[model samples]
Target chain A: MIKLTYRDAVRRALADALRADENVIFFGEDVAEAGGVFKVTPGLYEEFGGERVMDTPISEEAFIGAALGAAITGMRPVAELMFADFVPVAMDQIANQIAKYRYMSGGQFIVPLTIRAAQGAGAGFGTQHSQCVESWLLNIPGIKIVVPGTVKDMYGLLRTAIDDNNPVIVLEHKVLYNYAEEIDEAELTHVPLGKAAVRRVGKDITVVATQLMMHRSLDAAERLAGEGIDCEVIDLRTMIPLDEETILESIAKTGRLVIVEEAPHAGGWGADIAALAADKGIYWLDAPVKRVNMGGALIAYSPPLEDEVVPNVSRIADAIRAVMRA
Target chain B: MTQNGIALPAQMRQDMLKKMLEIRAAEERIQGLFLENLVRGTTHLCIGQEACSVGVAAVLQPGDTMTCTYRGHGHALAMGMTMKALMAEMMGKASGACKGKGGSMHMTDASIGLLGANAIVGAQLPIAVGAALTSRLKKTGNITVTFFGEGAANIGAFHESLNLAAIWKLPVLFICENNLYGEYSVWSKTTPVRDIAVRASSYGIPGIVVDGQDAECVYHEVSAMAERARRGEGPALIELKTYRFRGHSRTDQAPYRPKGELEEWLKRDPILILKERMIADGQLDETEFEELRESIDRQVVEVVEWAKTEPYPPVEALYEDIYYEG
Candidate 1:
């Protein structure tokens, strides 16, 4: 077993993907020699050489579009959007082109590509660089979305995403980059998507989250255990092929639900989960589904302001306690 | 022929003329279908841009890939997408190019190397670059081509794609069929510069302008650059100075066109230019040209009749082709 950070896990997965298949190529702004703006893709350029590992100009639409173009031609391209906030700049390619290519083309083209982007707040990237824009992408069909919360998931899910026969977006939370754990080499297996991981098992209330929120929810579950809350935390691995069965089954056992997400409460992934419970698991729910979200305001530059909006351990625990009372 | 000093046989010229005629006939039939309210949604016809399509397709080898914009009927037909499939797609039949999922705007056939046609302006540029990158990475001596309009030059994707393709020395030909208008606005109003080809200089790649009305000229220009690109000499932007005889879509009457502009372009019509050239050289007589046009017209009529009998996709189709199962 070896200790690895979430960042290291992602980089390891990338190196492995490139090594395993000659068809896989990586490119984005400062991703090659500069090692990416966040230092997540260093040494890949030297190891893979310039031909395979490329550095592109700051053109999100082009590079992202290039990923689509390259994928359709039987090349597996891992394109980094640098920050998820910059998705709007290339929204045309992501939502309209890459996602719709297979459906609109009558399945004539199989876009075997992965687009990795650093997302979520807590690093003080301010409003422009630290936003989580999954809602913008989740709305688009013909695309798969994967959010790996821990080092294990970061290693496993990325490997799965790279080999998937569709355009998959692998969103790496900026806050979890330094999160580390001990993992065996064999444990770096391809984790199938659409399966939720039960982080903590309990029976009182079901706590659902993804990315950083999953970690925070687990922390909340640990703290709430002392107060006899007995929370079951579920980590949603892939957002698109949502593991409804897992979430619903947990809701059934617990008879209550609290969704904590690192996004706005309105029209966010949390809302979708809440709706899912309302639609199918309403009979099992002992209380109205609670949502612990960052609300609709933009993340501020100051630490306190940012913390106030982002869902944390305390917020998640409070929500679980509130749901327990219900 | 003039620039590359390549000799063109009378039969090859006649074949090119036949393809151009086929596109012209299909477009005319599509317009008729639109008038009859048989076509679904909107339709963009490349009536006057036939030469650009024929020229670029002629330059591309069998395995070479190409992508075009929404106004891509001419390019699709020239690149070997069947008239039946295209007509069926326009009429929303199950046997359409995209199984009626994509109407006129998203025509695609991967088997013939057409990645797909894009609806959003300038979306296909990066995709073409990516395909070129695939050629470079796989060491395939094939060139990729992308067709866009003059208005696409002002978009960010166009600039980014040119820059990336140039820096990577990927084998691609950026074909800008300057059809004089974007949708409703004239080209001069949207663009600051006169020549779209000059923008290619920013990336230090060769940019050339060809008479878009002359299929032979466009063929000569694209062929020269395509060969050099196959040799890994980087990318080139070829501006085919063409015009659209009809409105951007079936709905518009093209009242925005300047006085006598349509007349001037029609006088140098791509099909007529070839027909007259061939006639002057005694390659084909007036009766022979009419016979060729009549054959294509009859084929288009048969496609429309067959497509009308074809049923729409089943309800289950809505849930299918959204993702590729591995």
Candidate 2:
């Protein structure tokens, strides 16, 4: 096993995809020269040359639409959106054109395109830069949404996303890119798009989290263990075709549940999980579902305000404790 | 004007006149179908714009692709989307080209190389460029043509696509169908430039303006640009000054266009001009032209009847086309 950061794992997956398929190409703003803003595409341009690893002009619409057009004509393009908040500008192409093509065409076309976007709040970036807007994307029917919380998960999931025949939105949490973990190097590890994984097993309460929040939940679980509170942590790697069975199975075991997410509370990923549990597994619950989420408004610029707005380990632990008490 | 009695080939002149008549008669029926609520969704009829479609499409070979705008019915038909399939698409029938899902705005028939008709203004520009890029990479010797309006000419996508096409010497022909308006709004009021094609010079390419009301003139220009593209001599921007006889969609009152302007364009009605020219130039007599029109009318009626008898798609079809899975 080779130790790799989440960012390096993504790079390896991209490199592997590029090497595996002659048709796979990477294009984005600063992706070629700067090696991506997060260094996820580091040294790729040098290895692949300019034709395959294209450094496009700062035209999101052009690059995004280019990827879609390329996909239909036999090239599998992995496009980076720089940040998740910027996806709205290219939403028309994504929502109307890319997502609906195969269904609208009655299976005539396969939009085998993958868009990787960096999301979530960290590094003190203000409202325009920092956002966790995966829910808006989750509403789209045809596209798959994948969120990888760890290095290994990121590697396996990204490889699967690249090989997917449908349009896949691989949303990487900005805060978790540098987080290191053991990863297999020899070949592509396939991580299923809609499955959840258990990060830690405990009996008292099931804590369901996604992206960066999964790590925070795991840390909180470790801390809560000292207080004699055994918390079960489930990382929801893919959000859209959610691993409902895994979440429900853990909920059945613990009977208490707490969902943690970094996006705003009103319509976060947690709300969907909570609703699913409420509608299907309500009778099995020992306590009402509790959720820890970012504040309703945009993340404030000030450090303290930003910290207060985004959920961390302490808040997740508190939510788990509160759910246990309830 | 002096070419009225000029020695143009009998077959070529007759072909132009017939195509214009087909577009006019077909679109006239489309308007009736739309008004009677036989057609589904919003319709952007290209009623007065028959010349551009016949002219530009006449230039393209069978393998070349076209990206069209919302007001694209004429192009689709002219590029060989059958009258019945198009009418069924307009009626939201399963036999329609997009299986009735795309409705009036989005129509795609990849077999005939009609990529799609995008409703979003200026969005198809870059997609066409990408198609051209694909052709160049594959060494297919096929050109990609994009049909947009004067309003789209002012958008960022237009500039980006044109510049990229020129820079790469890609096989792309930009057909700017300057109908003087976008939807219910006038383009001149929205843009600073008097001539939309003038911007093409900035991208280091030729900007040719053709009489959109003249099929032969439009055909000559498009054919020349297409030849240049196929020869790998880069791209060209051709502006076809045209007009729309109807409101933008079902809801618009068309208050933005002046009454006198409509009357002036009507005097130059493309189909009528083509017929008059054909008769005067000895292409065909009035009897032969009328006989051809009747034959086309019969063909269209047969197609619509065939579509109406076709069965609807199964419910399971909704789940089938979103992705390609082995």
Candidate 3:
């Protein structure tokens, strides 16, 4: 058993992939000598040398596009955007090029590329730096999205994402970088994508969460257990090819659903999940699905103001209770 | 034939003329097919820009790769893409280059190293750089050529990709086909610089301007740049002064162009210029040139006929090829 922070687990997984495949290379702004801004890729540059680990010139569009180009031509590149909020600057490459190339090319090219970006707003990094924009990428087809909530998942999912023969976006929550957990090395393995993990199995209500919200939902579930409210929490690991089967099965078992996400409530993936439950599992539901998410406002730098915007443990618990009451 | 200091054997000159004729005939057929409602989606034609595609692509070896913008039929045909597959793709047939998924703008054939053509203006620039990066990392001595229009020079990716390619000394050739207009707007209206190649100086890389209507001129300039790239000298940008005879899309008639502009460019048509040069050099007689055109016209007609009868992709294929299972 080894205890590691989410940041270190990511670093370890990246290092492992680099060591395993010579075709793997890492590049981003300050990702080389300075490690990453969040320290998620520390020591990789020194270990792999400059040829494998590179620091780019703060050009997200070019570097991300370059990653896709490299992927199609016999290289596995792990490119990082310092924050997810900046994705719009390079959205054309992400949404139009990387997401469509595989299908557009008639499967002639496989984009074995992984794009790692920091997401979420608990750090009070302001609107430009703290926005959770995973929902913006949810509609883009031919790209896989992974949001790991635990240190183990961070390691496993990063490894799996690097191995994927298509473009995969890893949305690492900025707040979860420092969060640590004990991971059994023997049990550590490739966590398959498009599958959800049941964090806590219960019968009263089902709670679906992702990334930072998954931990908060689990914390809320633990607290609710004392109040005789058994909440079944399912951590949605991957977002694009969503684990609809797992979610629907959980809803079938619990008869009620609550979704917790950090992105804005409007047009968010939470809404997609709520719609799925409504459309396919409506007959199985005991109440209208509740969505706990950020309000439709720019994330502020002030801790108190930001707290008012983002979903927290209490917000998740209250939503759970509300859904149960309904 | 000798033109712009580029002297080639009679056979090679004849082949070049044949290639340009093939592109011209194919595009003409496509225009007719589109008018007849055979093609499902709109197409961006490359009628007047044949020299830029043939000239730049002629310099590439078998392993060398290239990517282009939506107006990429000339580029694709010059890179050795078959007329049958391209015509089928435009008609959205099952046996098309991209299995009917990419339509006209996204045709690709990786076997000959034609990295998929991009619909987004400057999206392929960074991807070409990435392919160059792969060559550098693998010590594969391969080079990548990326083609974009004058409008793409204004995109942030152009600057970013040039900067990265310069710093890393990646083996890439940036070919800018300055085809006068960006869709409906004149190039001058969008860019401050009169010459797009001059912008390459910002990245400390060599930039050259060539007469894009002369295939021999483009071939000579791109050949020199490709030699520099293969020898590990880094990236270079070549701006081909060219024109597009047709509207941006099938639906547009280009009312924005000034009076006499199209006529003035039509006088310097790339195929006509090449044919005249070949005839002047005594490499081909007028009758021989006419015979070559008739042969290509016949081949294009057969390919289009075969494509029209091809089947559409099955509905079940919608869920496949998004990811590589292997």
Cα lDDT, all candidates? 0.90, 0.83, 0.90
Worst 10 residues of 3 chain A by lDDT: A181-190
Candidate 1: where is the Cα deviation over 4 Å? Answer: B1-7
Best by TM-score: 1
Q: Give the Å error, residue B184, model 2.
A: 2.1
Candidate order, TM-score descending: 1, 3, 2
Tens-digit lDDT track for model 2 on B48-122?
889898878877886788889988888888898877778778777788888877778887888888888998888
Residue B14, candidate 1: how far off, in angstroms? 0.8
Cα lDDT, model 2, residue B144: 85
Candidate 3 reaches a DockQ of: 0.81
| Candidate 3 local Cα displacement, residue A61, angstroms | 0.6
DockQ of every model listed?
Answer: 0.87, 0.57, 0.81
Indicate the residue-level lDDT of B66 in model 1: 93
- Native contact fraction per model: 0.90, 0.45, 0.87
Which whole-number lDDT from 0 to 100 does residue B159 have in model 3? Answer: 93
Per-residue lDDT for B30-138 in model 1, tens only? 8888778899688889998898999889888888999999998989999999998998999888999999999999999999999988888889999999899889888
Q: TM-score of model 3 relative to the true fold?
A: 0.96
Which candidate do you rate higher for lDDT, 2 or 3?
Answer: 3
